[model samples]
Every structure is written in C-alpha cells, then in structure tokens.
Target: MKNIYDLIIEDSEKFKDYFLNDEDHPLRYFPKFNSINIIVGANNCGKSRFMRQLMSLNSYDGINDLLLIRELIDEYNLYVEMFNIDKIQTFIDKYSRNIAGGTILDQKAVKIQKNRLIKLKEGDFKNIISVINGNKKKLDEMLGYSGMQDDFLKDYSKIEDTYSKEFKPKKYYIPTLRTAHSLFQIIKHGSEKKLDVPGTNDYEKIEKDIFLHTYLQNYRIDKSVQIFTGLHLYRDILNSRNSEKSIRIQFENFEKFLSVNFFDSKQIDIVAKFDKNDNEKGINESELILIHVEGEKETRKLYDLGDGVQALIVLMYKIFMSEPESFIFIDEPELNLHPGMQRLFLEQITSNKDLINKKLKYIISTHSNHFLDLTIEKEDVSIYLFSQRKNELNDKQFIVKNVNRGDNSLLKDLGVNNSSVFMANCSIWVEGISDRNYLKAFLKSYCDSIGKSYPKEDIDFAFFEYAGSNIDHYIFEDEVEKEDVEIVLKDIKALAISNRIFLLADCDASKQSSKKGIRLKELEDAKTDNFIPKIVWNIREVENLLTNEMWKEILIELCNKTLVKSHEAEILLKIDKALSEVNYSDFAKKYVGEFLEEIRKKMGKISSRFILNRSAYEVKSEESFGTIINKRELSELVFNKNFSWEILSRNNEIEQLTIEIYNFITQKQ
Candidate 1:
C-alpha cells in the first residue's frame, strides 16, 4: 500500500490541471491528518466547507474505478490483437471434412461409387455451410458478444464488486445540535427532500441527507423506515433458533457503550419500539423507552432525558455503530454540555478503547475552550483556529492558525487569567533586561526616523533571564538541564501561538572567540529546535552600537560631570586619544571596562540591592552612556536629521536583523 503522503503527492501532481473558480481546489489545502483534529473558529469561517471537501476527497472512488476499467479494456484489446482467425477457420474446415467422409474404403463404398459424384458435390456445399455456422457460434462464445446494455452491466458489476472488497471508510457527519429524535425521524419517514428545501435555515440538512442516503444504501434499503424496524430485525435474528453469535455480540457491544456513556442508572433498560396503533406515520410516535427495574417503576421515553444526555447518546450511537476506519465529523460536540461536562465528554470520546482500537478519525469543530483545554499536551491531536480576513480588494479569506500544545495564547483568548505576558500583537524575547530596554528604545527611534508612528502597546517586550544569558542557551552551546529546556521551550511555544515571537540574541564574546560572530547560521540552527524567528546582533552588545563620535562626546561629558577639578580641554584630549586608539571590536568594553571595575570594588560600600538597581542609572548619569537607553531620549537622538541608520544598515548582519524585526511588528498592524 502506498503511504498517504505519497498518494497525496502523486495524485496532486497527476491532477494539477483541475481547478475550482480558477483556483487549485480539491487538494489545495489538504491538512495533515492526525488521529484527532480540532478546528475552532468563529461562525461562518468555512470550517464546515473545509470538512466537506475532505469528505469529498475520501468518497472519490470514481477515479480509481475508471482507471481499473481502462486497464481491463487495454488487456481485452491486446487479447483481440493477438487472436488467430485463420487458425480457427482451418480447425473448423478439418472437423467438417472428417465428419463428411471416413478414412476406410469398403465394398459399400464401391457400391456407392456410382452416386459418388453427386454425393461429393452435395457434401462439399453442406460442409462449407456447417463450418461457417460453427465458426460464427465459436467466435460469439469466445468474445461473449453483447449489446450496449449488457456490456455496461458487465463492467459496472466488476467495478462495484472491486469497490466493495476495497476497505473504504464510511463517513458520518453529526452536525451541530443534532438530536437522536430528529435523526430517527429523518430515517423513518424518508422526508429528506421535504426537510432539505431550498434556502433552509439549517445548512446541515443536506449533509444529513447525504449521510442517511449512504447509510441506507449500504444496507441495500431503498427507502427510510422506523428505527425499531431495523432494531427488530437484529433482535429477531438474536432470538431465532438458528441465530448468528456474531450478530448477537455486536448488538451487545453497542448496548454496553450506551449503558456506560449515556445512562446514569443501572436499573434502566432501553428499547426501541413503535406505536403501531397511531394513525399518523411519523417518528414522533416511535419511542426509545427506558424501563426501570423490570416494569416495577414507570418507563420513561428517550425524550425525557436532558438535552445534554440526549446529545451524547446520539453522538455515541453514531460513533460506536459506525463502520470501522470511519471518518466522523461532529460540529461542536460541546453544544449542550456544561463546561465541566464538556471536558468529561471529550475525555470519554478520546479514551474509549473500542473507538481507539477501531482507528476512527475525528474532525470536531467547536467554540468551547473547555473542549480545547482537554487537548493540550496530547499527542496525535491537532488544533486549528480559523479567522476571516479581507484582502486589499476586500475579498474575504480564512486564515488558519495551528495552535501548538501548551500554547498560552489559546488560554488567553479563552479568557483564562493565568497568562504571564501582556497581550500584544507582536512579541520579542531578548537576552536580558538591558537588551529588551534597548530594542524597545531603538524601535521607537527607528519608527520616528522612517516617519512612522510607533504603537508602544502593540508590541510585547520580554526577556529570558531564568538562566543567565538564556539567549546563549538557545543560540549556542550551554549546560541547560533537560527540565529547564522544557520550561524554556514551553514558554516559547506559548508565546508563538498568537504572537509572532522573535528571539533577539546579543552578539557577545567576539574578536578572540572561536564561534562565528553573531551570524544568521546561529539563528538558523536555533530555529531547528525552537521553530521561531530569531535575530543576532552584529556588534558585541547593545552598548557597542554607540558610534565613535557618540562615544567621544559621552566620555567628554562624563569627565566634566565626575571629574569636578578636571579641565574640559584635558578631558577632550584624553577622549580623542581613546577614540582613535580604540577599534570598534572592543570599543564598548574599552570605555566602560575600568569604570565597571571601579564600581565593582565599591560594591561592599553600598547595599547590593541598591547598587544592582542603580547600576544602569549610574552608568548613564556619571558615565554619560545609559546601559538601558530611555525610549524618548533615544528616539529624539536617532530621529535627528543628521542621524542616519544607513551606516547601520550597511552592516549586513544588523541590517537584516533590524529589517526582519521591523517587518514582523509592522505587518501585524
């Protein structure tokens, strides 16, 4: 058997010419099939249409049947081409001659010699006529010659028999708010056409009719009948003197499922029965009665059950009674169930041993988050969230977003209060507080410089400080434990579901380091594991972004502020000498190296907490270079007409990273 993926790829290539509305249709968006797939979207986001397309794909056996017929026809044509008509005629002639005359000659032959001329002439003509007739009959028998109707029936029978032997799943669609009573009515009265009138409010009526037609056709039933009529046949077989044990066992299993999932009381026994005395022919007169303790208590009908229970009964009946390997589509299984019950209902469906063993595939469209919550951390389950968006020309299209396991955004969207990060259109995860503050300030400035307004609240800023330099743990080799890796991965996955998460790693430890300095390769490698977009800086750190001129000015101001007795001219000479001697490679460390060491030595003189909190402030105030740049000040500085990011853009690494981040946030708007 071909793998499903191989089949999809092969069929897609073979059928690429087919189109719908001038767009690739059938297999255009074939979703990756899993054991269970959950589709959640607002109303009318095309979830039902997408599911129907999948059903159509599954039911498409016509192509295979056609291919089979073509192959048989080719074989028949080859047989005809190889046939020897002359050889068959020779055999017929030989048989005719043997019958017309004997090999032996006797006294009788001599006596008949007088009439031999007349007899021989007559025998020759008769033998020729007999050979022609025999040849015609033999040819007809060999070819099985037939009219158009006979030929069509023969081929159709072959196709039907072959299709029946091939194990194709029966598809059952249980639309939203489907009730057992309504389904029973549809099946009993055969009112499908009446119920499926044009422009009906219930869009699922047509789908239900299709499902019912396929089901009844499978049983070789031409018309709808009461539920009890079908059940009665099964019961009669079970009670018959010559009963099939398999039939009894199958019915027993179905009853067991109902008792376990639907009924709350063990004393209640359910039975399908019809009120034969009623004049009206409708499903309303048909009843599924629940008998209590052998008629000691009054029996209750199925309608007496709560809506939620009835819904479950209908869903389970469809599932358990469905043919194995069936594709079951249920729209909003959580429809009538409460929040807690919804979770329990999902748990029951997913955990059922019979359902699991049968290898049933389920596609459920739901609006309930409780149902979604039950799927988190589950393997073989996929969740898709659909949204409708308009293009530039105002044409609407659905955008499907896959919700990863343990995604926090799903919880947030469902109104859960446990999310730690603030809601935003875009999120950026950086290495440290300094990097976060710097990028936020830089973005604001970059926007202003480009004459674009920056929406501060629209972007979420976060840092990975759980492990010192957590960014390095992700971008480079590190000793992060397995548990810590899982935690970090979960957080990353959670943020990525709704927000576009970009990792910003500082390009540190260059010049003498063996590592490739902050390059795209690092981000690419990280992507294999985290599967999120990332950026690495070209400079060693955010502080290194300060230009040589900016460095000189900052140093000059720092000396004027800290060195109360130092002359301005002296400070300028020292600053100019430092700027000229320092290469961009180690410029940030060169200027702040001694100053940071001085502050470290005085750490014991001040409270550790105060020093830690005031560290960035001290660098900005006394050293005239803020470790955490203020957004407004940085925006003003970078937006100056003389200031240009062109030089920064010239650096390929920083340029690409900046552009990626800029595009990511802007596109969300």
Candidate 2:
C-alpha cells in the first residue's frame, strides 16, 4: 500500500565511519513515502554522486553499512515495541532506587544485577535480529502471534533460513543518449558461433548493410544485415512474419500511447526488411526500419527524426525491457525533450503498465520544472530539492528537502523571488480539466436554483485540478533554517494546506464501489472519518454525468452539426448504433469509443461542414477521438446552461460535489 524508505543518506564514505564509530550520531528516519524518488539539486551538488553512493553502498560487508540503508534496525524496533523479552525490567528501576538509597542489597551486588539486566536486553535484541528477514509474516509469527505460527509453517523458506542475503533491489542505469543515437549495433545471430576475423566481411564487425541497403548475401552467413540489431524487436522477432505479428500490436498501441503523451499529430510508420529467406530461422537476419510519415511524397529515415522523437522510442524500449524491481537512474533525461513532452514522458513511464510490465523505480535527476507540475494531489512520488549550505563551522553539508505543491517556500527554492504564500480559507481539488469545467457548470446551476450567488474563483473559492495522471507528489519535510521560528511541516503538505479542503476523485472506473490508490483511500477516510469536504465520483469521471439520454442528445447534436443535411436520418441511426454499445456503468473512454467507431465508419470520406467550413477540431482517421473532439469545450457548451447536471435525475454525483463546494464557500463567506 505504501513505498517505504526507512533511511536515505548521502556520501556513504564520509558518513560510514561516523555512523559506525560514533553511536551517538543523531539518526534520521523517513515516514512511509512514495515509490518514484527524484533528486534535483544545484550544479555540483552531488546529485549523481548520491546515486553512485547508494548503488555502491552494498559492496561493503559491515554492520554499519547494513545499519545505514537496511530496514533491519527499523523492523527490530517495531517488533520489540509491540512485544517484550522479559518482565524482569519492570522492577530493575526499583533495584536502582534501593541501591541509590542503600536499602536493598549491597551496592556492588545491585549494580552487578542491573548490568546483567542490561546485557540480557542486548541479547534479547540480538535474538530477535537473528529471525528478522524481510518477511513480515514470519517475524510476526515467530514472536508468538498464535494463528500465524501455523501459517508460518507453510512457507518452508521462512523456517529454513532467517538470515537471507542482504535486501537490495536490482539496479540499471540508462546508457548515455550519445550511445543510443546511432540506433544500431550488429551482433551475430546464428545456430553456431561465428567469430569475426579481422579482415573478413562478417556482419558482426564489417557492418555496412544498413547504409548500403544491400541484402543479396548467400544463405545464412553473417556477412551483413540488421541495422537495428541492437533494438528489442530485432532480437525478439527473428523472421518477417513473427516480426510483423509482434510489431502489429506495437503499431496498434503506438498511436494510442502517443495520444496519451500528447503527440497526436506525429505519424510514424514501421518499414521492416527480413533476411531474404522469410522462413529461414536457422541463421537468418532481420533489419528493423522506421519511416517518419509527414506526407505521401515526403518521408524521412530514423536518424532524420528529431532527437526528442528518437529519445522517446529509445526510452520506451529501455524501460519495457528493464528487469522487474529495478532502479533506473536517469540523469538529465529532459535535455532532449521539450517541457510538454517532459511531463507526458514521466506520466507515461509511471502509469503505462501494458508496455512496461516490470516494476521499475525511476530516480531521475533533472533541472526541468515540468515534471514538478502542480503535484499537490499526487500520490506515491517524492521530489527532493537538494542544496548545499555551510554549517556552523563553515563546512559544506548536503541538504535534501522533500518539496510539495502546498509549501510556499518551494517557490523560493525554485528561484521565484517575489511570490508570497497563499492561504485560502476554502479549496476544492479535482482530477482533470473537464472535471473542473463540469463542476463549475453544476455550481452555477445549483447556486442559481437556491437563489444564492455562485462563489467566485480564486476569491470566494479556490478550485484546483490535479491535472489527470499528474496528481502524485510527496509529503513535505522542511530543511530550511527557521531563524529561531518554528514551522509546522504537516500544515505545509498538500493535504493540510487549507483549513477546509475538498478532494474530488474519480472511482477510476472502479465505479465508486471500491476504493483504490493511497491518496484516494486517504481522501475517502478524510471525508468519512475526519469530515473533510472530499468526495469520490460515483461515475468514472465528471463527463460521465451524462446518462444514456444525455449521451443520445449530445451525440445526435454532434452528428447533425457534422454530417450532411440529407444524411440526417442515417446519422440518427448511427447515433443509436453507438448508444447500443455503451455500458452505462463504465467510464467515458469505454462508452465513447463505440460512438467514435460508429461515427468514423460512416463519416470517413464525408467531411462535415462544421469541420471543413470553420476552424473546429479536425477529424483524422488514424488519430484519437480526444484529438478529434474537444471534451472540455463540449462540456462547457452543452452542459453549462443545460441545468440537467444539478437535477440528480440520474443520481447527481456532480451535484453533490457542487453542494460540498457551495457549503465550504458559503461558510467561508
């Protein structure tokens, strides 16, 4: 449920001896944190050095090394707090008191008894340490939890060896972009080992087939081929048919992935060439080709594409191929990509589970602020601002501060000089643009119905959107010198920023029945248990407030606006066909897909007057419906004055959300 890092330390060598020899050194431990940990620091502030230190920290075999990064000490502490070794310590204080008063036994004897108790406590800790692995169930049962002991017996490995290897997640650093730009390396692919003699024309060494475009070699000799031999597709798919079949799925999903990443207009085509013998798997070669499709007459090679484009492809390939439970340390990945692409890239890498099945922990060090876009409602990610300041003795010390969207001090750290803190009386945080738009419409409609003026934005109310897929930032931990003043960190974290705050979340297509995600569950508990003004949507998103009739009306209007006048009856039929496929219980993306497909099938060649006559959203065949239709515009145009949003005719989740906002704003006023 949470990503926990018990401790994070920097410059392992400089502090290793201090922690080992000086037991009095102060300890710093973190609360349960998110998974994606980023390190952004000033130039030469040990950003890359922190990565190197953590990776090599495990090479040493000392107790302090384990003490620093390992969660073993924390586990032992939690275990002992719940259960004690012996009850004898209860009276040890009495013994000490009597010895000091010269009333119990002789002074030396009593002192010896206390010493024995101290040694006994230390031994008890050591005994507990011997059984502490990463396995929680085993530790619980071993400490005499009754029923768990029977279940503990089932896991054979737990009983066999309590002291396993030191826990370290796998690590994989991305190769430099300079190495990836070439985009190809030739390796031998055959049944037997084919060594490259110095002068011979073997493809392993003398690889010029890609530039020469020559594949007229004899049967299965490594003379030439495989320009993209280094890529995953070339290695996995050995022949033409298999390559096409595998890439067909990629081709199917590539466009959608691009859509999510905001690359809607860009078109890429796969141009592949197999070994001359398509079925000859014995010693065959495959060359993966890519074409940049700008138009029918204009095409470009992979190298001809922009660096950001190539980096996107390369980054996905590397991430997808990464082993599970690995750390991918990427330094300055935003160098080639623009600001928009930077945000989209992080969003894609974090959530795209289909393309990336493995569990990867990305630790990117960057100078770009786009990745830190409005992370107030974000869950399971931490953005630590690294800075170095001189200590009391004028010695340099590293400082890592967990930054959140609510902290006004973060603006100062990011080099904004003039902005002051914002303390709103009441606030509402939603997930997306359309959610905000829909809520505003309902608020207006509801407030009008009740004869109360609607709350003004940023004055009477502060409406914040978590910018879909961008709602996951960390809890703030302060590092600035208070200058003899006390600052409460909890008050600065996003959740506690405003005195009365509302968090509006979608069910995420769990359909509001079950709760999922760390922040969503936290917000739910806040609303139910803490009486915070947060609500989870019953439907998937605010756009889904439109029921079947609402959808039919909207789709019919869209058809009438777009299609030819003579085809009105036929367009109505298509709208019905689209509505027949909709599952009312699901989200907009699911139900809207059917409408898009049916509309596209009949309206492909027929350009509508709304699209052609004026500058509305363009409808492209191979593009996404999102790019084709503006959902935000549609919500504002259709539902703003519709008054149906606040009616609750189909259960007004949005109307109820509007009520929470209204109450907050009214009380504040």
Instruction: Please estimate how well model 2 matches the true structure, expressed as its whole-model Cα lDDT.
Output: 0.47
Please, what is the whole-model Cα lDDT of each candidate in the order they appear?
0.46, 0.47
* Candidate 1 per-residue C-alpha lDDT over 23-135 given as tens digits, one digit per residue, 9 for 90 to 100: 42323333334567888767777676555444545322111122333443344334435554442344344444544675322222112222221111111222222322333
Q: Name the runs in model 2 displaced over 4 angstroms.
A: 7-33, 57-131, 134-170, 175-180, 183-256, 259-289, 292-299, 355-357, 390-396, 416-669
lDDT tens string, model 2, 260-356?
Answer: 3323334545454434432322222434344545354654445556777766765655455444555566667776775545654675665465544
Models, CA RMSD each: 29.0, 22.4
Overall local distance difference test of candidate 1: 0.46
Query: What is candidate 2's CA lDDT for residue 499?
Result: 53
